[model samples]
Target: METAVIKTPIGYAEFKGDEQGLAAVKVLDTATVTVIPTVLQEAANQVLAYFEGSRTTFDLKLNPQGTAFQKKVWQALLKIPYGTTTSYLELSKTLGDVKAIRAVAAANGKNPLWIVVPCHRVIGSNGELTGYAGGLSRKKWLLDHESPVKQGKLF
Candidate 1:
């Protein structure tokens, strides 16, 4: 798989994929060399646009690797609109099994694609920010970034 690391406001983000589609997008602890490939440049650009608040939705080919159930959960995550949040219980209900809340949350936590899959949009039933592979601060930042209330322009 081809990989590229690009700088973002929160931190560096690494994108991995090939001609078929993007397999993963991860946030790194530190900045790395920007070696973006031609095939993945569009994905990189879309991520940049997201951070800039110029693009609310992504239009890139995705090929996230996961189990069948995980894939189903991830696909449901895509339905979450920008600037809105959903609880694990709500997500579970949407999946047709409120009893599977834990399983749905597990799949969400295991999502391989980061911002693209929008796992950050999932929250606790009490409206609290929950576990995030990228850290709570990053998750909060993502939510605030997408918030309709404009505190100020994010450059």
Candidate 2:
């Protein structure tokens, strides 16, 4: 696996992958100083575009490592609209097992693709921000960034 780190408004983002496909994307306290492979550079560019609000969707090949159930949960996450939020309970219901809320949350937490997979879009059942591996503040930033009601300028 090859790794490259790029700076973002939130923090440094590390992308891991090779010629095959992108495997992981994680926010880090510090940036990595290494030559970025072509594939990784493309991923880095996409991430930067996302933060800039110019890109609303990602189209890179992903290879996140996880169990079948976890992959299923992450795949469902991708279907969530860019500006919408869903609760763990909603996710479980979407998966055809409302009783599996906890398991669904666990799988959501383990998603390796970060913004690409969009696990941060999931909230608590009461519409509260919950656990986010990248920190709640970043999650808030991401949600706000994707808010459809953009602020209009006053003349």
Candidate 3:
């Protein structure tokens, strides 16, 4: 399980695995790795493409570790379209348990795949941004970046 930690404009990101695939990508402020494999190269490239808005979906493979509920939330997160958002309530109902909003939100916070899984696209029922582990500011920036048309004053 070789890993590479690199500094990006957003923050320090540690990528594990090789160009054949990626296992996980962790966002950190500081970290060190003893070794890095070749697959992390492709992971880094794919992530860069995502930030550049050139990629809508990841082509790399991943084997992230999480609880079953967390995995389900992450899988649903992937279904959310780029530049769009879904409410926690919507996610709960869609998952066949409308009462699981809190559980859904918890899983969303635990999303280790970050931008790839797109936890940032989940919002409050009233359409307000909320509960982004990366912080609301970063979430807003990511959404604005992906928007097909920037919000503007109609005069």
Candidate 4:
């Protein structure tokens, strides 16, 4: 799989994938740019556009590697609208199993596509930010980035 890194307002985005499609898109504290392969360039551009506030949805050929259950949870995450949020219980109900809240949270954490898959949209039952593989600060940044109200813009 080809790999590349690009800077973003929040951090450096590390992309990994090939002809099969993007397998992972992780954020790193620091990294330098590398030549993005032909296959990964379009996705990279779309990601940059998203961070720039020009794009709200992604349309890449995704090939995230995960279990069937995990994939199902990710599909639900995709359905979450750009500026909306959902809770684990709500997601579990959506998946047809309120009892699977823990399991659903597990699958949400394992989402490898980061912003491309939007695991950050999930929150605690009480409307609080919760566990995020990328950390809560980044999650807040993402949520704020998607917020439609633009009373402030900090660059």
| TM-score (all chains, Cα) for each model | 0.96, 0.94, 0.86, 0.96
* 125 Cα displacement, candidate 1 (Å): 0.5
Off by over 4 Å in 2: 151-155
Supply every candidate's count of residue pairs whose N, Cα or C atoms clash at under 3 angstroms.
Answer: 0, 0, 3, 0
Q: Which stretches of candidate 3 lie over 4 Å from their true place?
A: 18-21, 30-36, 151-155
Query: What CA root-mean-square deviation does each model show from the true structure?
Result: 2.3, 1.8, 3.1, 1.9
TM-score, predicted candidate 3 vs. hidden true structure:
0.86
**Runs in model 4 lying further than 4 Å from the true structure:** 153-155
lDDT of 3 by residue, 27-146 (tens): 776666334456577777777787777888877687777899899989999999987889999999999999999999999999888787889999999999997877787788888988
Cα deviation in Å at residue 74, candidate 4?
Answer: 0.6
Ten residues in sequence with the least summed lDDT for candidate 1: 27-36
lDDT of each: 0.95, 0.92, 0.81, 0.95
lDDT of 2 by residue, 86-137 (tens): 9999999999999999999999999999899999999998999999999999
Per-residue error (Å), model 1, residue 5: 0.2
Which pairs clash (backbone N, Cα, C closer than 3 Å) in model 3? 18-39, 19-38, 19-39
List of clashing residue pairs for candidate 1: none
- Per-residue error (Å), model 1, residue 136: 0.2
Minimum summed lDDT over a 10-residue window in model 4 is located at: 146-155
Candidate 1: C-alpha lDDT: 0.95
